[model samples]
Target: MTILAELPTPAPTRAAAPVARPSFAARIRRAAPPYLYLAPALVLLVVWTYRPLAQAVRLSFHTWNLLPTSPITEVGLANYERLLSTPDLGASVWRTVLMVLGILPFSLVIPVVVGLVAARVRGRIYQAMIFAPMLVAPVAAAAVWQWLLDPGAGAVNRVLGVRANWLHDTDLALLTIIVVTGWHIVGFAVLVVSAGLSGINPDYADAAAMDGASRGRITRWITLPLLSPTMAFLVLMTVLLSAQWTFPLIDTLTQGGPSDATTNIYYLLWDYGFHSYDAGLGAAAGVIFFVGFGLIAVGVVALSDRVSHHDD
Candidate 1:
């Protein structure tokens, strides 16, 4: 009776079992499906894009006519040397810059205005009409424009009562190409801008209106800031891919002719590779353009990221 109650023996605490990590093979098995899905695209990219790019770089160091019968002779930067030496290279670059500048009004400014108008109007038919040009095939559109710009029996001349050879005159040819390319591109830009506008929250405009903001002020501060991302994208596309966009029209209508007024780096590369049968020169130009444009594209994206407003 006097004995103290025996202290209950402490129950043995079971240690928590360590969680086992998955085996390497198990992790790989889990990842296999995604990689397998990506494999086809990776293979195609290597086969078509990267392989050709690598071949072009290799060919830039050699002289070849792109003919099976022609042997590739190592030239060791001669192609690049010749490219740098060409006097027209400077002029071509200047013209390319001019072409981009010329197209900017139609591609960016006008399209933005039109898109704003369309957004207010909300007319599907009008939007369809505006976007119709984008649906036309580039070559076909070029062909049609060639007819329209003809000095004789052309709709443009007939309408204006001017007999200017829009695609033949050295001064007019490049301008004509820019106009045609812009016409094709503007519709796409309009559509893009319209879509962007549609995606914006209406509350911003309503809030600005409640604050007695003018329509112009609302657009300048609210609308444009929200649309800045889309606008930046449009600018990037217009600047970087402008040459390719104008290529078909130039090839079909001008063929880089009328004193090469419309010839851009893209056209020059084509002229060297196919027309002049100078594979090394073409490859060298391609490599140079690729590097230059790649850098320019990076700069544009970086600038856009900094400049564009992302907040709602």
Candidate 2:
């Protein structure tokens, strides 16, 4: 009886149960909420960003003076060709590079150092003081700086005991613009860096310290590696936005004066569109800039992904 029980035996035949699947309407009901939740943002993006981008792209192929009564003449690649052949384009591009390099120390390097220290400090006053400059409107800041940097009666000249034309001199105008732009945006950069620093896990530094690591070593190996993501972001912002940050200041103060010393690509594009009334040229330039910067942004993001160390 034991041997027979241990052996395989035939069982009664039974039908397999049908697997239950949700109806199409039920599936639609489940998926609708996420798309519904996303709809407003999607609509705004299309209306504001994508629509303008598409219009710019369309306008790039046509020549127009931006007058409502004037007809747009389709010029194919003429606008782009003319823009590229212009000597001013090359000079403006070089100046833009200088701006990016000059702004890096203020926006990326100083902010990282200040933010690291600021993260440990306990005071709203210190934070406010560091971030105060960013709160001032760009136009207001430009006006204030114009007075301070005036060649003859300016406080800066008086303090230095020398009358140097800060805005009128071609050599100094670009540098002055860079400095002013840096001052305006450095506070915002510091705040962003401080926020990033706060998100870092301090246990890594503490553990390194416990292991007989020196302060510098702990910071270099533990803290900095963790802070790489923030630094990369700052670098990206500084590179891409250096011109934009200086635009209002340049527009108000220099007006791209002193032989176009302070003119960058952003200002150049604006000059073409508004000052020269060459809408087609401006549109082409804008499209080129958008494409070029988009590529740079992609590269930066890819590099950051490789270099940045996340806690997770």
Candidate 3:
């Protein structure tokens, strides 16, 4: 009887209450604040940047004169074909390469040297003097160079005692543009490299000095390696944006003249769309350039990643 009573007297179990899932409205309520915060930026990006990009892509497949009255006629790959067939396009790309190469010494090498020197020099005024060019407006700088580079009666030609048309001559036009662009952009590079130099620990240099390392050796081994990341950034920026940096100078000075000698891909695109009124061709070129540059940028980043040594 005791065993039967004990077996029968098991405590009654209560049924578990089911957990409630959040409703769609509750989920939306929880997410509302972040979305609200992001709304303005998202709207602006969609309206200004993404929308124009999408429109350009769409327009690339169609012929458009950019006139409101003109109907957009779908031409499939014709615009791309035309771009490929253009002789100037190929030449423009090569000139662009040369431009980047020409600018590299000024933008990367010279600035680095100047920055290193500036670091050793104990004056903020010296640093400011180096960076003054960057503060000037591009158009204003171009106008000033326009006067200085004049073939006849210009200061440069007068000083050199040569009546050389610096900007108008075919052989000299592109090179002249490169030099001007470099002058304009070098100051910015100096500022950037100087900032990088400032961040490097003096202890490294001190330690190397104590170890009997020469100043040159210290710079070569310690300073440069630590500054690799900054150098890489400058290199990448110079390569990718060289065309853009030269645009204002090209517009104001050359206008893509002297047999299109100074016309890089950037100018070519602008010439097609604005000057030639071939929006479709310009859009096609834009798409190709965008893709090509994007790939280049990715490759550069990868290479920089492998080469750059983070002090951290």
Question: lDDT winner among the candidates?
Answer: 3
In candidate 2, list every pair of residues with a backbone clash. Answer: none
Candidate 3 C-alpha lDDT tens digits along 188-290: 8988898888889889999999999999999999999999989998999998999999998999999988889899999998898888888999999998999
RMSD of each: 13.4, 12.0, 13.5
For residues 76-103, what per-residue lDDT tens digits would candidate 2 score against the true structure? 9998899899988889989999999999
lDDT: worst 10-residue window of model 3:
1-10
Residue 254, candidate 1: Cα error in Å is 0.6
Off by over 4 Å in 1: 1-28
- TM-scores, all candidates, are 0.89, 0.85, 0.90
Which window of 10 residues has the lowest lDDT sum in candidate 2? 1-10
Q: What is the C-alpha lDDT of each candidate?
A: 0.86, 0.87, 0.89
- Residue 263 displacement in candidate 3 (angstroms): 0.4
Q: What TM-score does model 2 achieve against the real structure?
A: 0.85
